[model samples]
Target: MSKQFAFTAEQLKSFRENGYAGPFDAYDQNEMKETYKKLRAEIFDRSHAIYDLEHSSLLAGYDRHLDIDFFSRHIMRRQILDKVEGILGPNLLCWRSEMFPKYPGDEGTDWHQADTFGHASGAPQVVWPMNTDFGGAITVWTAVTDADKENGCLRFIPGTHEEMHYDETKEMKYSPEQVNKLEKNGMKSGFFGYDYRNLQKDPSWVPDDANAVSMEMKAGQFVIFWSTLMHASWPNTSSNRTRLGFTARYVPTSVRIYPDTDVINEYGSKLSLDKYGVVLVSGQDEYKHNRRLLKNARGLEFATALDELETA
Candidate 1:
């Protein structure tokens, strides 16, 4: 039997080999433009946000989907989950979401992969069963604006997800002063404020740029990729354009998010997970290892359709 909106066998084959897929359309251009305007304004008002930090805090982008109505709905959209379900099975949970904004003159994201997601925080953010060799979320990144090479679109090294090149247990120093000052192979890129290269298992092993593909996407389109993929972005060389990406991360219900932590420390800031809860996007959570919520911090309902789909 086949599933609607699920990836075709050919596409799944490609995803397995390339570690990424699509520039799929999730919203109409005009609709996205209007939504972008609203989101731009709404993002500045974090009065009802789950995190108790200022709007301009670096960690402010942590989980807007938990409070913003549009983001809340976006995470549960069938267009995205349908494809995600093809890989993660039916019982899925959106454990985290974050905003990546690259403005004019901003450095591109450094090439990196995340498994346990402990490189920066010194604590694992996501964990899988001991028997499983793989552990990472499926990140669906939506382009809020045109993402072209000149405007800092994402890039990936094909087939790199199976083998991790970096050690997540390594420590990285956060130095805001090194933001635009460091360059890798003459490319202007850095992972937030820290150098992602610091976590590399082999300090001398460089990424294969010859196999790197630029993922330029139009506004309202999205791409799905494994969080364990070797991904990076180009610097926004455009004089005026800003590239914005809304990343929603998903994992099977069996995976544990923030395993045993109440506080998160990363990106030179710390946040308490006092109100954090995983939004179940599809199927029922049989494991119940993580906290689940049905509503946002602002009282907006996080609609689910588990009963309407097959459970894993």
Candidate 2:
């Protein structure tokens, strides 16, 4: 019998053709509202957070699954893993999670594609086995608040994941002042502080937005897509709404996480990996290339992989 939450054959076919999939339900609206309130409080108190940075730091949102109880559980939810298991097989590891928040009038995220995720850091954060032509993590982005174009919802260009439009090895200069100052074809957007267009393989190229699709998800819902997909978001034009998104990145256990790296220097900040470890959300890890943490700093044990739990 098929596993619960597993994608149907038709859905798998659509995912293959479109290079992305659903805004599936992960939480109820009322539940999300209450959970978000608690999350906000926990987010600000980072005494036990993996990184030894201030709460106000730009990279403060890097990985709270290591310390926060809610995030630890959220990352391992069966609802997310069941669907992710469909694309990545059963063996998987959650290598990273990040918070993306856009306030009213904030600039949109620039069109970008991340395969190795080295465009800014100058080192491939994740590496697949040799001879593989393509390598990219599957990103599950969940909306912590209602997301709409008026509040900077995500945009995706279908069927673009198979191609590499940008060279991630290229370096992009980080400039915080340029956040809301840049405009792409009259669209207000910028990649955090860096201009993502700097890493484009073709300087004269521009993503054809005519074929792009806006993904507006309600709070507590999630959309899954390839990190290599041509994706971006629109500027928040709302008067007071804030769009919050939490992204959890997953990859097969065979892949190497932060190959031979102890520190990550990106987004104008250098973060040490002394407390960083990958969480195995599903199946087993045979390669053992990365450190695996079985629990959060709060002594809360992570939920075992669905298959593992079912068998045990």
- The clash count of every prediction, one per candidate, is 0, 0
lDDT for model 2: 0.89
Candidate 1 residue pairs that clash = none
lDDT tens digits, residues 165-235, model 2?
99999878989778788997887889888988888899999788899999999999999999999999999
TM-score of each: 0.95, 0.96
In terms of lDDT, the poorest run of 10 residues in model 2 is: 51-60
What is the lDDT, from 0 to 100, of the residue 6 in candidate 2? Answer: 87
Candidate 1, superposed: residue stretches over 4 Å from native: 1-3, 54-57, 305-312
lDDT (C-alpha, whole model) for all candidates: 0.89, 0.89
